[model samples]
Target: MDNKEYIASGILELYVAGSLSEKENEEVSALIQENPELLAEVISIEKAIVQLTAAAKKDATYSFNDIKNQLKDTETKVITFPKPNRKQYIGWAAAFILGSTLLLSVLQNNSLKEQLSAEKQQLEEQINKSSNSLADAEKLIEVFRDKDIISIPLAGQTVSPTSYAKVYWDKKTNSIYLDAKGLPEPPEGKVYQVWSLTLDPLTPTSLGVLDTFTADVNKIFTISNANQSEAFGITLEPAGGSLSPNLEQLYTLGAVAS
Candidate 1:
């Protein structure tokens, strides 16, 4: 169970108030030991209640002392019966103090709950991102391990000397996985277009264009290529791919090794 959710449930408040069942109290106690923040919250709640109770007692004592002083000033002899008005005043004063303290506790609990909720949301987001990254890594690993997959290393061309990419082709599936991690992001209104080349007459077949190059984190793309490809080349083209290979803008090229 999520510790943040448990804390936000307001069970900790009830635990401090001694309103939870014995079993529930034990569970809360165990949780507190595991989470220092939760334990701190419980301690704060308890401390606030204790301080309020102490302040109320001190105020009541002071009021009683003031009453005794006033009575002695008015008359030298002691009263025969206890003063009812004094008792009524003390009762009302204690009730008011208790109500205020209860109100403060409620507000504090709500504030803490809101903070816990925000923290929980942030934690969940981080977990989701981590899970997605792990899934992507696993998929890449599987692609690399396939025996039938032809691994082609495309070297950088004159346009981008440092740019490089790898193509993992599964001939049975007629699909290629392009790992473009080494390629630089295309400029605005431009994208990378991949081609399956037949070197005989140097004819190029459009495999597909990478529209999500900038957005893709791993820069891995899947493209279908049923052609008996002799070589693979990538070029920087307009948003939509050109009909023919733009040899001048070629970024990377590699031939299938016999």
Candidate 2:
């Protein structure tokens, strides 16, 4: 029989209880010797039984040594007499009580194991979340420390007096990291659009719409801009970005440093 199947058959409980026949006992001992897991299972079962037995009898202490001694002893024989004494009846009653207690202990042990396993899984999930958060913080720190990056602060405009944002432009990569944490969440059916402006002709180029406005945790967006941008502006537009920014709906604007 498969070792797992044998272990799960409740045979280990009987072996620990010293209820198995001599031949069956030898077979289990050989299996336990070969498989460390099986040996561990047997030891756990034995310990639970001993604890249950000891708890059942307040005055008695049941140790592994006592259990081993009992296992080595020959099977008990029932001898018939003309009259059975009260001692024999009391002994039989005690055996039934101990058996019931052992069953309950086994059930409680299984429940505790299940609870421990669930807690272990929850701990692992928390560890993974913490690791991801740390990685994101490290990456953001690197972006701030880069030598080729320039910070441009965008102040609130007439449309939204409290709104503000920042743009970190990386000259070497021609990429801009838009930090819009201070901006209010967009309204229904409306999105925030970013623009790269040229002051000479007052031209505006649509960088892109902030599609994941509400879901983005960092509120930081990356957009490629190779233009000779003199200023940057943000406006509230329709679902998809507008061809040209609406001057009336412009929320924030900042001019590039000369």
Candidate 3:
């Protein structure tokens, strides 16, 4: 018969429980020694009965003595029973569960740590933005504190109706801070130059080139004007600026009122 039919006969469970005769046990052992599949099926059934017997007892251990003592037969087996690995199996199972729990906890902690790191980075960025805003306000306050600064507002000219400029000229210190935020950029290879003008002869003195006009974040240019200037005008000149002003390229003009 097949291993299934042999196992379904219920003889293997009886043999494992020591309920079979001596002759039947020898016959079953001989068949298991020849057929590996039959031996496997018999061992599976035997394991179930062994587990049930082990649970019925209060003690946590079962050695070969226990198996032989359960047989209670004079001619049951020619060989001794194998030692039970009850303690070792229970220890390994407990260790496996503990290791699995520890690994899961570590993975969960790493996920939380990554989330915290992202939140901390976002908070740092927010703090930096607020600090930069405060620094800008403080810088503006310092810029407006000069006592010798003469404020001059230049309106839009015919060339650029939207252009405007504010000049903070410290005549006593010979320094002028020009705010050209409202002005449009000059064409390629051209730059704006500041002219300190005299009203009587309409003569112009070159202060300096308004370099980095577009690059300045505040759009405020600080220049030195040592001349006795009555008016100021902005003209687009070549890259390095000219020795004098070009009226044709004049963008805006305003007189320094007394």
For TM-score, the strongest prediction is 1
Candidate 2 lDDT over 86-186, as tens digits, reads: 67876776776687769878998998999899999999999999999899889777888898788899999998999999999988899999999999999
Model 3 residue 162 CA deviation in Å? 3.2
In candidate 1 the C-alpha lDDT for residue 245 amounts to 81
State each model's CA lDDT, in order: 0.90, 0.90, 0.83
**Candidate 2 lDDT trough over 10 residues, lowest sum:** 76-85
In candidate 3, stretches whose alpha carbon ends up further than 4 angstroms from where it belongs are 1-129, 141-147
Q: Residue 187 of model 3: what lDDT?
A: 80
lDDT per residue, candidate 3, 67-174, as tens digits?
Answer: 774785577434333454776776766777688779988998998999899999999999999999789768656666866577888777777777889888887768
Task: Residues 1-258, candidate 1: write the lDDT tens digits.
Answer: 687787788898899889999999998899899889999989998999888778766433345766773564455543243344766777866776688779978998998999899999999999999999999889889989999899999999999989999999989989999999999999999999999999999999999899999999889998998999999999999999899889999999999997
Runs of candidate 1 exceeding 4 Å displacement = 1-94
Report clash pairs, candidate 3.
none
Ordered from best to worst TM-score, the candidate numbers read 1, 2, 3
How much does each candidate deviate from the true structure in C-alpha RMSD?
24.1, 22.1, 26.6
- Count of backbone collisions in candidate 2: 0
What would the TM-score be for candidate 3 when compared with the true structure?
0.50
